[model samples]
Target: MTDTSSAGWGLRGTAGVSFAATLEFDAVEVKLGGRVVLDHFSLTLKPGEIVCLLGESGSGKSTALRVAAGIQPVHGGAVRINGTAVSAPGLNTPPDRRGIGLMFQDFALFPHLTVLQNVLFGLRRLGREAALGQARAALRRVGLGDREEDYPHMLSGGQQQRLALARSVAPRPGVLLLDEPFSSLDARLRETVREETLAVLRETHVTSLIVTHDPEEAMVLGDRVALLRHGRIAQIGTAAEIYRQPIDLSAARFFSPLSEIESVVTNGHAPTPLGLVATPGLADGTAVTIAIRPAGGARMAILGPGTPGRIVGKRDAIGIDICEVSVEGLDLPLGLRQPSDAGLSVGQDVFVTLNREHVLVFARD
Candidate 1:
């Protein structure tokens, strides 16, 4: 029986154990060109759940996926699929036998092969009709029911990606690995195709691992997002948990844009130009970084008189305006959302107030 335990994101029931079994990587380490790509990396991807490996370029996100997919040999570590040992030190399982499907960033579709042929490529061992039936069904699941005969160049970018997804899931592998699969598509198309791809994965109950550097993408698609830093697993948690309670300053700033202000605890609250409300238990003179979200800070007009900032500048940020406030004694930039009142301007004095409860405090390390 498949496990269906609720764990992260408040996602329960069938959505919980979407993957049939956990893909386990124990103490994995990989080196490339004499540089450590991954060091003592480890994580468990539960069944029916999409786990996103999130990081920037060369942060070892893709390398982890390759290691789990049985493509890259590990320098030292163990990889297991459904609790079955596949690789460790010297014993490496061939990619074909690993029961893994890799969705490349470029889709990796054969230019010369038709959509049907590409999907049926893995189904070749079966009879022609049987292979075509499965391929057609997979294509249909991805909403590309009528594009079977189309060549790679003939399909739109979105359609081509859908075809690639169909081909990957055609074999119904135990685990599906996506390496920045949506990176190449245009934004609108990317969202549409990603939604479609996710829906199909849900319907088919395909256990998937997606690797991407984009945080928002990770939040949208993952059952849990694991942040990798300098070749190690930094933090693995639900989107809510990671966003709400990041482990350290690095992890905190990584997922969300946060401005850290050095503050000293006075009485119960930290004394700042904005005014201290209440933050108890902090030792006196203890230095701490107060994490302020870009969207949550208040403008001087909103905070009445006695505020401590001067309007530095303002910029249009897509939908909302982002106003920068300059505060004395704080080297960090204070970010505030544009207020309705147009009273503040460059060099205009204003007071900024932080909602103390929502503010996160991290001891300076």
Candidate 2:
């Protein structure tokens, strides 16, 4: 791991700027093959903050990055960097002149160029000595100082990612956009490289927008997460806010697997197989769906007492045991994450206790 504390690759020409460097998307729209991809989408990224655009496939995560990078034309609204409109009606700036850095998922390093040459590729406008200095500092910041002479093929997957990152930040662009840069790495290598990339971003203090489909990756790297669904932003907030207080059932299920139960609101509460859950601001007799996450504040115990449920399925998931319990009168089985020592079997009986704080209630359609 590289030490980011002494890394001096700061933003260029921002010495006396009063306002923070910002990236704003105002009511941006996009269409592909006569199908709407992004509709009236808007976002604002403050200086030195990392925001992750998170969603499943076809949710417009990549389109948002392209629009910000000025490679994709917007059908409506505008894209502003540092309050200057670079993308708007009848006005579009070329990608290379936008003062933005982008790293594609494939790394896109020049196969014929050495690591130092690739890093210096973005610094072409600077003098030879200055570009060399900046490239060396960028490589050192990413812990690839010793591999400057090696070609991309000679480096490991993680090192290649670092090299790509070094190249992107070498010019000290105001905003960095990464489109699923870590998606190609294996699980273990992804974790290591992701951490290194985040460290470099933090030390450099460059505003960034990273696009990813993995919920865990979004939560780990983003200061705030923008959850997209069907060409619109479903929710935007910190990871805890989005996970704990999702706007709807779909948003809640996107972050974690949920067991849903049907109920009707009565006297500000609803009765379930677990217990009565408070339903404030909802009228009586209103149909509601109760969603619970097995790993979210819920406790499971043996059939010694409480609501009895028959275990219908069981599986060992590496460090823990996941069991599905079928309760009487419930249409779907409740999933539980249990300790391995519980000695649970498929035919055994168990009891489930719901943590009201972890339960999410939404009006049933």
Q: What TM-score does each of the candidates earn?
A: 0.87, 0.92
C-alpha lDDT (0 to 100) for residue 128 of candidate 1: 86
lDDT of 1 at 306: 54
The candidate that achieves the highest TM-score relative to the unseen native structure: 2
Candidate 1 lDDT over 1-365, as tens digits, reads 43323211111121211335579989999999999999999998877788989998999999998888788899998999998888888878988888778899999999999988999987877798878787887776665667778799998887788788878878777788999999999987777677767766776677789999999999999889999999998899999788777888888788767767778776666766566745566677777777777765444453556557777887765566677888777786587775445555677777776766557777776
Residue 106 shift from truth in candidate 2, angstroms: 0.8
Assess candidate 1 and give its TM-score to the true structure: 0.87
lDDT of 2 by residue, 91-139 (tens): 7899898888899999999999999999899999999999999898887
